[model samples]
Target: MTVFISPLIPVVIAVAALVIAVIKDYRIGTLIVVILAFTNVGGQQIFEAYHVFLLIIMLTAFSLTLAVLRGSVAVQGIKEFNILLAIFGTWSFLSGVIAIDHELWFGMIEYMIRAFLVLYLVYNSFSKGEEIFRLFKIIVFSMFLSSIISFFAMIGSLSLSVETLLSLFSTRFAGTIVDPNFYAMTIAGIIPLAFVLITEEKRIALKAFWIISVFFLMLTIVFSQSRTGIIAISIIFIYSLYNLMRKKRVEILFFIIPIIVILILIPPAFWFRMSVFVESLSSGARADTSVVHRLLLLRSALDVFLKNPIFGVGLGNFEAIAGRYTIDPMVCHNTYLEIASNLGLLGTVPFVLLLYRGFMLPKHSMQNPNVRELSWAVRTGLLGMYVAILFLSVPFKLDLWILLSIAAILGRKISSEKSP
Candidate 1:
């Protein structure tokens, strides 16, 4: 019952809203999307494996049936890239079918369930521009709230139940995330929303809260000392500000000035942690040395790739091959390498193309001012995600997988528009 306000509910509700809105008022359906965006990232889910997957299955079946009955096979905004990723994802899915290791194949296909949902959201997103704006507001508010908690947790202020469990032994800014880097990566994506919120949200109370969230979230990133999250934040900040400028949003100086001022007043300790990570990435080379241990992980993965290069070793079998290397098996931290290592050229190409086209479509759609606001906001957020994942990790979380599925739905829209 207490979980009713849980952050993750908004995302699924948004998906459901799209279905309902598609039948009647897309604007109403669009409200669900907004709620999910705001409530997107918080804590990990309690029930794992089957329960979550079952929900995804139900959503997919329902969405597909609704779309087909409507003759469009999608809500109003369904784009071509959505279908392409689904199709490409299927190839990846098929590779799982022929995968050498039983467990890994099952896991790879399991992950794609979220991909399907993202496509659903995107299909619905294209329904109306006002809804997109509304969703962006929700995304901003959620980020603001989460950032504040994370900041306090990092600085020795507000303590959360999740933090107590994760750092019961150690004091780090893992926050709502299971890993410090993952936490950092997720927050990094929030930077764009924060900037956008400060621009669009004129109410003084909202502005005060938004400003506070930014300061603290930045503080968490600093102490957690995640290089990727920090870097991604910088990139997103610059990119978003550029977008605002392009749109000529310079009139909001009264609001923007105070927020900018607050961001600059961060404690020096934050920079100290960041400096150390930079040192580690460059001449420090300690993290690299530790990464060297992954050589063993990579070699073992390569052995599997050699045997299954056409389809490769399959989606989830990276760990199975680890038996030849060491007793305790693990993930290859470099997701791109792991995918290539497991799935081979044959399996990896289609998936990459789907991402490539999905990312590109928003840029093509940005010429229209209304379309630009909605499309670029997501794209800018994605740009942060792209940057963060490269340094932090790949798409492993339920939230991330679900977001990808929404991207696919958007991809379908682009594909349809570009099609003959």
Candidate 2:
């Protein structure tokens, strides 16, 4: 019962308190708003998995429209996202309108709706910056608790009543989300937040606590052995260490570690992931057992592109189209190939712009120490996600979609305050 409720209860009470506070006092609403956004992330994503977030998105549109019409451009970050979503949505409809493949059209609309909701949270959440920070603190606090429970559960250190409920492999150790890879990636993503917070943390004990959390998070990351999780963590660590040791020599050390990782650690795993891949490239079609399967899927997608050329096959039609070329019904694990094959250059280009811009904007984000400091956690995690994508065909996941939307909204929020 303790493990069952450990993850859920505090946030629930925080939400109730937040709503009550918002009704009773406007100042409290600030924190409430942030609390709401922070708590909502995994929940909404999980809800969406069950197809509920779609209904919620429609309701949100109505609610948000009321807010917008009242001249409450109060959430400029959300506003920019709406703008981008509009572009994305408009193009989505264009795909439906022009798409020869019908399934792709339906998929595009579904993708757009979810994108909008994610944008909404990001946009509005920033309006409560201090609250976001507070909620972040709360989240880190909660994560710490989760870690503590998980740690003892590991070594037979405690024979707690909830011990049976805790299984590190499937359930117990998840930071917030239950999936180990997602947990690692998300934790890695937020390291910048901790890094930023540590700079402001005055209490010696609190500072030590946050530092310890980093160690715990890294341990789990390595434990997960999800290639992307490790890669993402490494990327964030480099960024964090660079910030910590500002001297040129320290920066070089950051770069040097990766060389050692590649030389020492990555070879075995990389070779394992690439064994069939290297063989396939060398001898042509003989080796089909490895990550080369994904590469094969890419070639099939390219063939579909060549055939359709203009609009290509259609969203989700890669299965259908690829089957026409190969007996096996395979999906393109490569996003670029999938996008071009399905929607062709037209449907895929603008969305690519959205990603390109989001990825590019972080460099500019580094300009201000405050924004950098504040956003670095998310940014660091993003850097990891970026590096991870080279190995996994994961960018198309709504996980990334949600992440990218939040980031864009935050960047817009920060930029808006700077402009005026």
Candidate 3:
């Protein structure tokens, strides 16, 4: 059926693109990776079994490794964070082996492959500041493209009548990205990038372009109607306001006015959705149905962690085994709880350390003013993503890895410049 095979379209296109890019020139791999990052947000859904982004990462790694070994490309020093990542990935795979349920083991293995490749390839890809700048261009362009798609999709869906309006608000704008929340998160993640670009660029035309881009990106987030997305935008804006107040007070208007416009233009349904959060808090614990389900899911994850405290119920086994604990089956919505449930304390420690190290490097990169400023944006974006994962199980999403790649590359660049 067309419905069943629709997902294959992205897979085939990605495969062809990867093949051509590799055959034409190895440097094209970076471009393809950028495409994969953008596509993964909402584009990968075309293929039900499509792990093309992972494939692209693996291929790029293999090609880059061959180039290095053959002396065609200079070898960059491996960072400690990458080694820690490898160790954690190995542990994750081992944990999967002892999993109580094997139905989803393959999917877990696939994710481990993608995560490892992202850590290794991103760290190795950029050896110079210029390369990082090029990557940044790709990121900015991708965000722009994604935001445009989201805005248009929302417009196309809008219709007359309260019935139509209600349905529109009920449905989130997916755009090229399949899931509304993920699309919104992607747009939200790019908010800081738009802000940084708006500040850093000197040209009046360019600044105006970024301003328009930022407005629509904000609109896309609003249209997606995701609480996580809204919170992510709030986080970015707060970070922006704090940074701007300290450094560039006059320019804060570029950010503040658009944020106010977005809040004012938001539909009644979105406001109601947001009110649920406030209402849930006021009503006491587990009062909201959605919040109650999440709490129950968290409890179920904790139960799994307690039962399998060492190796875990196993990777991908949480949903299968969690049914015993909860009336309805659910994946671990919280990333921390999911990691704890899947890998237990033994694996969770290294995994947490990997994330910590990833974060701290960016924090330390503040030595370079440019790196510091950009890192602030990247850090806030990653934080937003982490917040998002608290509501959705997206451990292997390519956009998160791309953000990590950017953080790792910036941190490494800073470290490399520290000379003997």
TM-scores, all candidates, are 0.70, 0.67, 0.86
By lDDT, is 1 or 3 better? 3
Q: How good is model 2 by TM-score?
A: 0.67
Compute the lDDT for candidate 3: 0.72
TM-score of candidate 1 to 2 decimals: 0.70
Local lDDT at 182 for model 1: 76
How many clashes would you count in candidate 2? 7
Estimate every model's Cα lDDT from 0 to 1.
0.56, 0.55, 0.72
Model 1, 261-289: lDDT tens digits are 53575346556555655665566654454
Looking at model 2, residue 317 earns an lDDT score of: 69
Model 1 segments more than 4 A misplaced: 1-45, 48-79, 97-100, 146-170, 202-204, 238-290, 294-309, 323-328, 396-420
Those runs of model 2 whose alpha carbons end farther than 4 Å from true positions after fitting are: 1-49, 52-84, 97-108, 128-132, 135-188, 236-290, 325-330, 362-365, 391-406, 415-420
Best by lDDT: 3
- The Cα error of candidate 1 at residue 304, in Å, is 5.7
TM-score of 3: 0.86
